[model samples]
Structures are given as C-alpha cells and as structure tokens.
Target: MKSFDVAIIGSGPAGASAAFELSKSGISTVIIEKETLPRYKTCGGGFVFRGRKNMPFDIASVVEKEFHSIDTYFSKKHPHLTTTRDQPIITMVMRDAFDNLIVEKAKENGVTLLQNHKVENITFGDTQILHTTEGDIEAKFIIAADGALSPIAKIAGWKETRTIIPALEYEIEVPKADFERLSQNVRFDIDAIPYGYGWCFPKKNHLSVGVGVFTKTNKKINLKEHYATYLQTLGITEILSEAAHGFVIPVTPRTDIFVQKNVFLTGDAAGLADPLVAEGISNAILSGVQAAQAIIESNLDSEKAAALYTAKLEETILPEIRIGAKLSYHFYHQSTFRNIVLKKYGQFVAEAMTDLFMGERTYPADYKASVTRKIKEAIF
Candidate 1:
C-alpha cells in the first residue's frame, strides 16, 4: 500500500489541476487514472476565454485554432448575428493534448501520476483507503474528480441531484477549401434543436460538429436528425470519418453535498457543469483548485477542509450555477418568452453573454432583482 497526503482520481482537467495545485504547494499527491495518457476524450474542444484566463501556464502550443468572434444563429430563417472581441473569444484544442499538457505540468511539480489505474473500491475508516486495479492507496484526503458518472461519489453514498444530458460529437475531416473557410470562424446555431444547440468548432485538421440537448424538459428531440440537419446547413457534405462519439454531460450542479468528511468531490464528479451552456472545463478547474486550496488552508484537517470547501462553493460556484439554472429554465423551456426577448434585445444579450464568457462579467449577480426587472419590462 502506498501512502499519500492526497489521492486524486481521474486525470482530466479537474484531477490534473488539483494535482498541480497540491504538488506545487509541496503536498504529497498521487493521481490515479483509469486510462493511458493522452487518450482521446469526447468533447466539443472549445475552451472559452474565461477558462483560459484562469490557467496558471500558457497553452499556446496546444491551441489548434483561436477565434476572435462567434457567429450565432437563432434559426435558419433568421439571419445569424456576429459578436466580436478584441482578443480571442475561444481557443480550440484536442482534449488529449490539452489534458496531457496539464498532467505533465503537474508531474513537473512532483505529482505522482499512475496511469492505467482504475479505482475499484473505496473503504472509509480511520484513514481513507482507495482500492484500485493496480493496488491499494492510503491518503489523508480524497478528491473525486472522476467525471459525471463518478464511481467514487457513488461509493461514498452521495446521491446525484444534477440533470445529466446526452451529447453527440463528430470529428469530420472536410476538404481543404471547406476546412479553410470554416477554420476562420466558430459558429453556433441555437435553433438547431428544441432545447439545445449545434456547434461547428474547427480544429487544425478537422471540424468538431455536435449537438446537445437539455433532457430535463419534456421536449422530444431526435439528436441524430438535428445533427444531420446542422451539417447540411453548414454545407458539410463529405465526412472523412463515419464514426460518431456519444457522451453524457452534467448540465447542473449537485445541490445536496460536495464534501463528506475527508472526501471532496470536484469537477464533473460534483456536477459543476454550467446549466446554460453545458461547459465543464472551467468549473472543473475552478473546483479542483478550490479543493486543493481548502486542504492547504485547513492544514490537512479533513473536517475543516470539507467545511471550507462547501463555504467556498456556496460563495462562488453555486451562486452562478443557481442563476444559470434559472436562466436556462426560462431560455429553453419558455420558448415564446425567449424569442420575444431575443428578437427585441438580441444584440444586448449577445454582448452580455460574450462578456460573461470573457470573464469580464458574471451571471445575474442579483438574480431575483434582475429577473423581476426583466419580467416587468417584458410585461410593460
């Protein structure tokens, strides 16, 4: 059995970020990953500027494409609108490369990364013991950054409270002409599905085209049909590959509990994905850092660390998630109200969203007041 100060499960953005922070603080940290390094991860691969701003190191080498503006389409009938920023709005990178980069940085900071080790069972007692496929590990603290369907979280008896949504993505290699044209801009069609959106994000060599749906609503939407329609609308006639990747995304944060004794849940394992846009990487990294910070600040006191983590989440992440959930409910479920607001204040909303992505602003800080004002104005 190996003993460590912290045992982090999963080596995605969340795990790697936590390991990086812990190791940098001179904590004995070990990352247990189920897969080999640089394995392909299913994602749209669009990293928003908000995430980019928080990273401690530069990712310029891994960035495949950088977009200065986004083209948003409300529907096929309505003309698409463009939002521009002086700096790049989003940077596209393959998850394999991006995740590998972060893990390597953690390694540089003396983090022990054990690849191909899957956590099989976790036993709690005087000290937490993680039984993995390779062997067993003893750690003072456990950070479950495993993912949306986190086995560690389940083993800890944490009931899931977030909504899980289904998503599909295709990495299509188009012709040189089409690739060049599409690579110049990032596009999102909000009306591609009933309660979802379609995106075309260009990589250095391929385009990541995908469709996602918020399944909490009663709307019945065929994701496959919508994906095909989206490709057709984009004039992507030829797909070099036929294989499509499917995955589940957590769209809401878990409200029940994030910390239990010595065990702390971060990233998708904690259901920290944004309800409005379904983005997880930013919150993943944020939660990872906060988890490590809690342990460091509490001097490895598990009970105190757990309390601090919950307080931090309540002060920062949960508030934004709550507001986002409210906005998502209105924006997706109430279609008539959404259309009216967009039709009248489309530009203002677009700019505000762009600012939010850029970290220049946040979601309704006073959600109730803001919503009340909007409702009154709408009715008037």
Candidate 2:
C-alpha cells in the first residue's frame, strides 16, 4: 500500500489548494480524484477579485472576462445600483480550466495526484486507510474537499447539518446580437425569482446564466420556470446551444466538529460557501490553505492540527458567515424594509457591498448599527 503524510479526497479548488500548500511546505500529500483533469464543473463561473488576488500563482490564461463594475437590479423594489472599483470586481473563468490550473501548480510542488480514482471506503485508525477502486493508500491525516456531496465526509461519520440550497446554471450560446448586447456587463437581477436572484455572467464565447435560492426554504421552487423568466428578462429569446446543470450549495458551516478522528473537512465538504452570495470558490480556497497550514504548523501532530484548524476558522470565516446568514435572511424576506433602507441610503449600502466583494471589508459586525443610524436619518 502507498503511504503519505496526508491524503486529500477530490481535486476541486479546496483539495487542490490544500495540496499546493502542503507540498510547498515539503509535506507529503496526495490528491485522489474520481474524475479526470479539466472535467466540466457547474458553477456561476464568476471568480471575484478577492479570491483571484489571493491566489499565489498567475491565472490570467484561464480568465474569460474581467469586470471593474457590476450592476444589481432590484426590479422596481428599489433603484438599480451600479458600483465600480479600480480592481476587477468579478473575474470569469470556466471551472474545468480554472481548477486544472491550480492542480497543475500543486503537482509542480511534488504533490501526487491519482485521477479517476473512486474512493470505495475508508478504514479508520490512528493512520487512516483510503480504499479506492484504483488502489489503497494510507495517510496520517485525511482532508475532505470533495464538494457539497462529499463521500469522504460521509465515510468519516458526518451528518447533514448544514443549510444547502439548490441552483441551476446553463452555459448558453445565443445569437450574436443578443450575446453582444448582454456581454458587455455583469448584472444580477434581484427577485428575478421568489426569494432568490438571477445572474447573467458573460464568458469568453457565451453567457453563464443561473438562478440560486439563497435563503433557507422547505417549499419546493421550480427553478426551470424561473430560469425561463430570467431569459426573457435578459432579452435572450433564443439560445443557439446550451448545456444546463443543477447543483446545490452549502451556505452555512457544519454545526459539528470539522475534524473527526484523523480527518479534516474543507470547502464545501465543511459547508463553507458564503452565506449572502452563496459563492464557495473564495472560501473554498481559503479553508483549504488553512487546513494545510494547520497540519504543517503542527508538524504533522493530528490533535494539534485539529485545534489549529478550528481556531483558524473561528478567527474570521465562521463569524463572518454567522452574520452573513442573518443578513441574508432579512435581505431576501424583508423586501419592504430592505427597499426602505436602500431608497434612503442606496449608494452607501451599494458601496459597502462592493467593498465586501473586493475583500476590502468583511461582513461588518457594525452593519446593524450602521443600518439603524441610516434609518433614523430617513425618519428625521
């Protein structure tokens, strides 16, 4: 059996990022992926500048589009908001290429990759054994970064304790006129669906359009019905060619421990997608790095690594998500009040949101206080 200091399941952004960090530190790490490199990954494909700038290596080769400004339409609930910044607010990239690039970088740092290797089961002990269709490997620690439906996490004895919401995305090729007209800007239409939002992201040769229900709901939502409406809203009458895929995003972190025995969970496996926007790419990469760093800083001590990883998340990501979850609840449900706040302090709030996107600010603990102050001003 093959052995390493750490074994990572799934070669998505989180796993790839963790592999890159660990191998760079001269730690023995291996990435086991069930699919081949550059496989199709369903996502909004909007890589925000916050995540892009933090990447250690250049990824300009895969970037399809870069926007310095963004438009958000509230559909008459409030005034439309446009925000701009010096840095690109959102960078677009196809996930297959984007994820492959990161894995390649990790490989250069001597991380081993086993592609098309499906993990069948795991035998837990002080050193875990990962049984896969391809082969068996032993590692002192296991990092589960396999995305929303994480098999590794399940095998490690995790239950569904996170809030997961569904989304549908289409890679659409439209008529030249329609594509040209809509491809110039990135726009998000709020309330394009009930309790959800729709986005039109322009890619190099097509539009990546999707709608996601960002709030928690038990009622059924027909996403296709809403998607069709969104197409009409964007004036995309006909699609020359399109590929639609549906997936779920985990917006809240798991309430349980991130580490179990010798296993650690990162990215979607740990339910670390951003609560407000439901974007996982940025936090996926960040959490992966932190997990790897914890292992490294602990000098391969599993107990210390677990504690360090938890501390790392509590320091920022978890707290931010907690507040973001609360804010998202109100932002979607309290439309009347949200509109009131927006009407009075539209530009200020818009700028603040843009800053949050740019990583210039985190989810503000003082957001409530700021909104209270603005409401008083409006009332007076």
Q: Considering every candidate listed, which one attains the maximal TM-score? A: 2
Deviation from native of the Cα of residue 225 in model 2, angstroms: 0.4
For candidate 2, give the lDDT of residue 346: 82
lDDT of 2 by residue, 107-130 (tens): 998999999999999999989999
Off by over 4 Å in 1: 366-380
Residue 206 alpha-carbon offset, candidate 1, angstroms: 0.4
Q: 374 in model 2: Cα distance from truth in Å?
A: 2.7
**For model 1, how does the per-residue alpha-carbon lDDT over 240-349 read when each residue is reduced to its tens digit?**
77559989888788878898847899988988888888888889999999999999999988888999999999988888888898888877778776776676677878
Best by lDDT: 2
lDDT of 1 at 67: 93
C-alpha lDDT of all candidate models, in order? 0.87, 0.91
Give the least accurate 10-residue stretch of model 1, judged by summed lDDT: 367-376
Candidate 2 Cα errors over 4 Å, as ranges: none
